[model samples]
Target: MGAQEDTALVRRGYEAFSAGDMDTLRELFTEDAVWHTGGTGALSGDKKGRDAILAYFGELYSRSNGSLKLTLEDVATGGRYTIGVQSGRADRDGKTLDQRTVIVFTISDDKVIEALEMAEDTAVASEFWS
Candidate 1:
């Protein structure tokens, strides 16, 4: 993929995720795309393939009660690297689930090959994962 295509993929993926558009995200990942949340219970480990990504996003949508939205803090793309910081509250049952994270994505051939997430604090992530 060209530089423009790579940037667009990253932009679209992040935009779709922010809008909770699971359908669009499904088309942006490889069959074995890995999504790691550093052990965050809401998102973690290898969510293999487009199916898994859709399922995980579905879980978020349901659990958040439609309050699950991402507002990107920053985004930078170069070659196969895209770094994005987003903050959102995953709300459910009138309770708010704070999920402020910075995600670094590795893209290949205009598809997301890998995603690594870092919570606002590792200690907080540890507790959430636990």
Candidate 2:
């Protein structure tokens, strides 16, 4: 796919996520996709395969009681990669978490094969999620 198409696909994926469209999100990823959560915290880990990644999403939903929301600021692509700048907010246990995040996606054949997520403040995010 072209760079513009890749960015569009990534944008659509973010839209799906924000809209709680899990089916669309699933369709954007390859069957053997992997997700890397970057941080030195309990929530940091690598989830391999589409099933594992979706299960992680389930865990996040349960932890946040389905109140988490993501807002995308921008998306760009180069070669086979796409980068998304976004912010996420959620309320859990009477505490609110609002953080800026950058996610890098590796795309192949118009599908996301891998994703690596980085947060603006890992320690703060860890505390909030913990």
Candidate 3:
């Protein structure tokens, strides 16, 4: 059940994210799911949760002036595992925000328990993360 549900969750989550559907993505997460990047990478303890995850992105998307888009280039699936290649551009002042990301997700009981993301180009992403 873990692997099956995890596969479904991963596929749908990325599809929703690619469409900027935060509501759908939120539904896939556990109350303590973790989301982070940069110096704040992989938040632990209280920082882990659905509410926290949503709030984190809410603030992040707002900073981008709501011009955030992500597309999954490819996905590899295994028992309780998924890896995806993603490309996205953030525009807020007629300028693009470098956000090429490679995301890894872990799901349990049909809900996401862990979400990890890294910049595909560490250098370019480092410039954008801050």
For this target, which candidate reaches the highest lDDT against the unseen true structure?
Answer: 2
Model 1 residue 70 CA deviation (Å) reads: 0.4
Q: What is the TM-score of each candidate against the true structure?
A: 0.79, 0.93, 0.76
Model 3: residue 123 alpha-carbon error in angstroms: 4.4
Per-residue error (Å), model 1, residue 125: 5.4
Error of 2 at 32 (Å): 1.1
Ranking by TM-score: 2, 1, 3
Write the number of the candidate with greater lDDT, choosing between 1 and 3.
1
Query: Pairing residues by index, what is the TM-score of model 1?
Result: 0.79
Top TM-score prediction, candidate number: 2
Residue range with the least summed lDDT across 10 consecutive positions in model 3: 38-47
lDDT of 2 by residue, 1-130 (tens): 8999899999998888778788998999999999998776677889999888888787777889999898999998887579999999989999988989999999999899999999898887777766
Per-candidate Cα lDDT values, in order, are: 0.72, 0.87, 0.68
Alpha-carbon runs more than 4 Å astray in model 2: none
Poorly placed runs, candidate 1 (over 4 Å): 2-4, 40-43, 122-130
- Report the candidate with higher lDDT, 1 versus 2: 2
lDDT-based ranking, best first?
A: 2, 1, 3
